[model samples]
Target: MDCHNYITVFPERKRGQHLGREERGAIQQLNKQGYSLRAIAREINCSPSTIMYELRRGTPLRKSHRGRTPEYSAKRGLAVYEMNRMKCKRPHYITHCSDFVKWVVAQVRAKKWSLDACVGHARLHQLFADKEMVCTKTLYNEMAAGNLPLSLFELPEILKRKQNKKGTRKHKRLKGRSIDERPDIVDLRTEFGHWEADTVIGRKKGREAAVLTLIERVTNNYLAIRIPGKNSESVMAAMKELHAEYGERFSSVFKTITTDNGSEFEEFSKIEAWGSSVYYAHPYSSWERPVNERHNGFLRQYIPKGVSIEKYTYEDILHFADELNSRPRKRLAYQTPEELFDAFLDKLYIA
Candidate 1:
C-alpha cells in the first residue's frame, strides 16, 4: 500500500459558518497539547488564519514568574464574540425617523387612523422623505415586536378574526323589492347616487334614539341623521327633511337606496315615490350591503354598543360623520370622501 493513501484529509469549512464554544474549547486543548496551527485548523475544520485571529482575541497577558505570559481561553473568546455580535447588528429604522414615528403615533391616537392609512397618505402627499418613513408592513411588524408605542388592542381591525361559516337560511319576510331585482351597475359601484341605508340603535330596550346612516356607492359620502327612534315614521321624517334639503336634486342624488328587513325601514319602499328606487336585502343578509355595514362598524368606535345614543347631541353625531367622510380611503387613491363627493356635486350642478 502507498503511504500517501494512508494520510487523513479534512474538508474545508463552509463560508459564513462561525466558530462555536466547543470548537474554541478544542482549540484551547489542542494548543495546550503542543499542536501546530495547521494541525488545529485541520482538527477544527476551519482555516489556520481563523485560529490565529481567535488566539489573538482570546489570549490575555498574565503576570507570572516569567513576567507577562500570554494565555488563550475559550471563555474569553466567547465573551469577545458575543460583544462583537451585539455591535454588528443593523440599527433599527425608528432611530432615523423619529419625527415620522411621532406623527404616526399622534394620528393613531388622536385621529384613529389605521397604520396603512398613515403610510399611504404620507406617501401620496409627499409628507416625508423616502428615507424618513417606513412601509406599512414594517410598521405592523414593529408594532408586533413592541417597538412601537401603540398597542395592538387599539387597532381592532388588524387582529386576526375567526370566520364563521355562512349558512343558508329561509327568510320569513322581505319588506320591499328583493335585491335580486337590483341592477348589476349598483353592485359594481360604477354609478353615482346609488346608496345603502341602515339604522344604528343604542340600548336595544325601549324606544331610545338612533342614527340613520346613508353611504353613496361611488363617492362613499356618508350621511348620519339622528332620529327620535328606530321606527318607520322616524325614518320617513328624516327622509322628508333630506328631500327638502336637496329639493329637486334629491332624486338625482339618491337614485337608489338598498336596506335590510329591519322594522325601521318597513315602509322604506315608499321613498321610491320621491323618484329613487328602493330595494331590500335578504333577511339575515347584512353582507349584501357591505359598505354601509363597514361604516356602521366605524361608527361603533365613537358610540359603543349598549350606550344610549341620546347622550350625544345632533352636532356631535354630525361631527363623527364628518370625521369619517374626511378620512383618506385607500380605495379612493388617498383622496377624501368629502373631496370626491364635492367634485361630483359640482359637475352635477354645473350640468
Candidate 2:
C-alpha cells in the first residue's frame, strides 16, 4: 500500500469499552428522534445495554410532559454520564453484606459503640463469618456511601481539633510529683493500677458541677466521679470518698495517678498519704496524659460542651463511664475495659 493512499481507521468504540460523553450524547439524540435502543447502539458502534443505560440515566427524575412520554436530553445524558463516571470505582464488597450492615447500625445506635470497636469486637468473637462482615475502614466507607444508619455528624467523636496558629508561652504549675519522676512501670503499662486523671467541665464557665475522670492505663478502664464543683476541695473529697469505699484495696486499686496541672487536681498529691502516688504532667502538655484527655473528650459526647453538668445526676455520670467501660477496645485484644479491670482487681485481691 502506498503511504499517500493509506487510511488509518479507528473503530467508533473498542469492544468492552465504556461509553464516552460524545457516544452518550449521540445515543440520547438518536433516542429522542425515535430510534430504537438497538438502532442507537448500532449507530454508535456500542452495545445495546450501553444505549439502554444511557437513556435510563438521562431520563429526568420527575415527569417531563403531561401527555407525551419523557425524552432523553443529550446534555442531561452527558452530565449524568460524567457524574457517574466520577463515582466510578470498584464496587465495594462490603455493600453486599446486608446482615453486617444491620449489625453495625444496631451496635452503634443501641450500644453506642465506635466504628473500630464494632469491627474489632466482631472479628475477635468470630461473631460472623469472614465473608459477612467488613474491616473497620470498609465499614466507614459504607457509612460514607449512606449504606448504613450512621452519618459523619452522628458519630460521637471523630475529628481532631486544629491547633491555634498563634504561639504563646504557657505557664503550668507542677504542684505534685513530676511525671518525669514516676516509676518506669507505669509508662510501660504492664501493671494494672496505673491511672491517668482529669476533669470534664461543661460550659467551661462559673462554678458548675464537673466530672472527675480516671482511666486505667492498662485496659482503658474508665471511672467518672461527679463532684459538686471542680475545686480542690471537691476533688480531694471525691478521692477521699473513693478511698473510704475501697478501704485497704484503695492503695492497690490506684497505684499511681497521673494528671495535668489543673487547679482542681492541685491537691491530688495529698492523696499520697493513702499509699497512692500522685504525679503531675508538665505545663500545657495534655498529650503527656493522653488516656485521661482522650477519655475526657469522649465524655463530652454525653455531657456535651456548652451544657451545664448540673442537670445530670450522679448516677448518670456513672452510667456514662459504665457504658464506655463495657465497650471493647481494639488495643485490648477486643476485651472490654470493665472485664479487664475486674480481672485485675481479682488478681490484686488474691495477691
Candidate 3:
C-alpha cells in the first residue's frame, strides 16, 4: 500500500520551546511565501504565539549591508564551553572513595549496571550525590586515562570493543573464488536469488554438529540446513535439498551464494552448477558474513555445544528454522520473515 506523508503542527501549550537557526530559516521562507500567521503555525505545528515570536524576533530580515552589532556575539557556544569547563573543575569523589569506585567499576564490568544506572542507584543508596555522580562519558574517560586500573573493571572482557580489521589480505590462495568477484545484482538481492551463507561449528562435538545457514541479506529472511558432516558432499546435499524443497521460488530468490574460507564450502562449483554464483569470505573474517552468522547464533540457542546435528532429524531442523523464519524481528520493525518474504514477492510482481 502507498501512503502520502503529511506534517502536523504542534499545539499552543509548549510555550517555552526554542527554535533553532534552521527552524528560523524555515519560518522566514514560509512567511515570505505569504502563508498567514495561523496557517503558518498550523503548517509548522507550533503555536501562533511561537510563529509570531519567530516572525518578529527569531528571524530578522537580512540587511543589504551590515547594521547594528549584536549584544551577544558568543551565544550558545560560550555557554556550552563554560559548562564543560565547570564540569571538569568539579572534584572527584572517586579519588576519596577509591573502594567505592572500584566496586562500581566491577559492577560495570559484570554488566550489572550501566554507568548512568549505577550512578542513579548509588545516589538512591546515598553512595553518591548529584555532585558525585559521574557521567558515563566521564567514567569512560577516566578508564582510558589509566587513573583507574581497567583490570579492576575486568577490562579485557568488559571494556573491550572489537571492530573488523581492514587492509588485510586473504589467507587462502586466489585460486579459490573471492567475495569481490560476485555480481552487483547478487549484492543487491534484487530478485532474491542471492544468499549469504555461513557454517556453524560447536565447541563441543557431540552437542552441536556443523549446520549450513543461508540468509537473504536484503530482507534478513533466513533458512538453516543441518549437515551431518562438514565435507563437500554433505554441504552439497544440504544445498540441493534446500533447492529441491523451495523449487523455482527458491531458485528465483537464490542467485548467488557467498561463504567463508572454511574447507566445508569447497563444493562451490557444484552449487554454481545448480545456477548460482558462489563466493568466499576472507579467512577469519566473519563480519563480512554477518547475516548468515546471526542465523547460526539463533540456531545455537536450540542446538548448542555438545549436541550432534546427526541427532536432529531434518524435519526437526526445518521445524526450528520455520519457527525462526516465522518470528518477528525488531530490525524489520516486528515484521515476521514470512511477511517480509511475501512483501518481497509482491514487490517482484509489481516490478
Residue 173 alpha-carbon offset, candidate 3, angstroms = 1.8
Candidate 1 per-residue lDDT, tens place, 48-163, comes to 99999999889985657785568799999999989999999977887799999999999888777888889999999999999999999999989988999998867867774756
What stretches of model 3 exceed 4 Å from their correct place? 1-167, 185-191, 203-209, 248-250, 343-351
Ranking 1 against 3 by lDDT, winner: 1
Candidate 1 off by > 4 Å: 1-17, 29-72, 151-154, 159-162
The residue-by-residue lDDT of candidate 2 on 1-351, one tens digit each, is 479866687455776777777776677678768898889888888788877887788787656446766677777877877888789978778767788778878888877789999889988899889998888988777777787767776685656665543432256557977888999998888987999998888877698899999999999999999999989999999988999998999988999999888888867888989999999888777778878888887788788788999999999999999998988888899889999888988888788
lDDT of 1 at 59: 93
Best by lDDT: 1
Kindly list the per-residue Cα lDDT of model 3 for residues 1-351, writing each as its tens digit.
555665466434354455545455566677667788898777666788877754544334555568763221123333444566688886755576565677677765544344444555465457665564665567767766676655433433244366766764665663367877877766554556567887666554443456777888777777777777776777888888877976765546677778887777776666666667778878777877777876776676567656667678778777777866765455555456777887877876676
Which one wins by lDDT: 2 or 3? 2
Off by over 4 Å in 2: 1-89, 161-170
CA RMSD per model (angstroms): 6.2, 9.7, 19.8
lDDT of each: 0.89, 0.84, 0.65
